[model samples]
Target: DRGAEMEWISQYPHEKEILLPPLVGFQAINTRVERKTLVVELRPSLNLKSPTIEEVIGKLKSSYLTLLDILKGSLQAEALVGPSEERTELHESKAKAAEELGLQRKAHEETNPRWFNNALNYQEASTAAFAIDAKMATKSILAEMKTSGAYTATFGGYQMHKLGLTGL
Candidate 1:
């Protein structure tokens, strides 16, 4: 099998094994919607599986709900500046984006609670893509610009939609 060279090439198969999951895991995390726009060229090198139609729909629904919740939290529309103000601004930005993205803010509130909750969990998981070691050095600053070069690729916008991003 193709794997025969895998062991033969290295005495430290353990090292290879250990490195394997983290790399795959990180790629899984980095290849989502929000992070995609910031990590363009690096995207294809990750060799991740593209989400299928059903998977895409599921991702979209959950992301839509998460955006709804964040929007609900930031209706005040206050100006968020500096580190202390960043969190509030980010929340407001996310909420505003959801509105612009066709999330149907009013109707989202009346939707099934169970489905909504599930979407929140999915959003959290997808957000981890930015946390991978490959991204640790540049995620915060790069992602903030709404132009980390992540979306230069065709799949970027689609992935972002899956993650519930709208106005980026």
Candidate 2:
């Protein structure tokens, strides 16, 4: 573990030089290593004229928006597929039951009054509600991050690996 930590620390200068050119003055203000965790505290380089705070802010905002969009799209797609399939099956069963009973049935009326009034309407409402909630949550998180002077960002390791940055 100590060896790994030493290696990581040793590589920091190179990583900073290549990945954080704009943050040329950044320094490790503090560091701590637990059993499996290594935390290196950093602050803006004192020697730098200006830090790229705007770039960091822009990246954060873009990431939040992209995540929200993906979440909303996934929710909408699930709503469209899940409940609609069940509704179709129920509707068909109702039509068959009505025919067996020799009862007149409306062309577009629902078989079960307790079920959703309409599958399309339910799906649309569910999708819209989830999208709105996700948007609100994203807004709240971004606002909090903006207000907080200390911002912590996490990157997906899998994504980095895919991009061939794992060796870095």
Candidate 3:
């Protein structure tokens, strides 16, 4: 049987305890290399992909206050007509801010794995220690949010369901 392969003749595969994090909600292992090491990854999964902060914020803003957006946009358009020097200074300030933000994001990304979301694991573990089902806790929170009614008005439904549980 293939079970013989589990005991490698060379280097032991489990010599290094690789922790497949609960992050990204691993649907399937896409790749396996057998030489001197083992590496696992989710090649093409939506859960593995994370929308940039800018993209998520933009999508949320667009989905939430759509009518207000049109009105505010028109107002901003009318207000955009300003003194040339003032506009030039504003443009320069925005450019500088954007550059700074880019540098900070780059630095953070160097140490992070596409926002792997290890924070949620802490709370889930804590709840588990207390004998609480994380799923039921999430449902309770969703029900409370629904009763508040703001979540339904914002993203329709199911948008916030698996947020903390999965990667994206």
The C-alpha lDDT values of all candidates are 0.42, 0.43, 0.41
lDDT of 1 by residue, 1-168 (tens): 111235546778765432232123232334334654654223213324855445555655566656545543433242233455446444445445435433454555455534634756445533542222112222323355445565532324334344433443
Please write out the lDDT profile of model 3 over residues 1-168, one tens digit for every residue: 111233354367665333332223444555687897676765322343666566554542333234333333433443354665555433343344334434433444433332324556333423332221223344445555676975642322344444643422
Model 1, which residues run further than 4 Å from truth? 1-67, 71-79, 82-95, 98-103, 112-155, 159-168
Scored against the true structure, residue 63 in model 2 reaches a CA lDDT of: 38
State model 1's lDDT: 0.42
Candidate 3: list runs displaced more than 4 Å.
1-87, 114-116, 120-168
Error of 2 at 49 (Å): 74
- Pairs that collide, model 3: none
lDDT of 2 by residue, 56-145 (tens): 434433333344445544434433444554644333433343342222112213233323345574454345434444443443444445
Question: How many clashing pairs does model 3 include?
Answer: 0
By lDDT, highest first, what's the ranking? 2, 1, 3
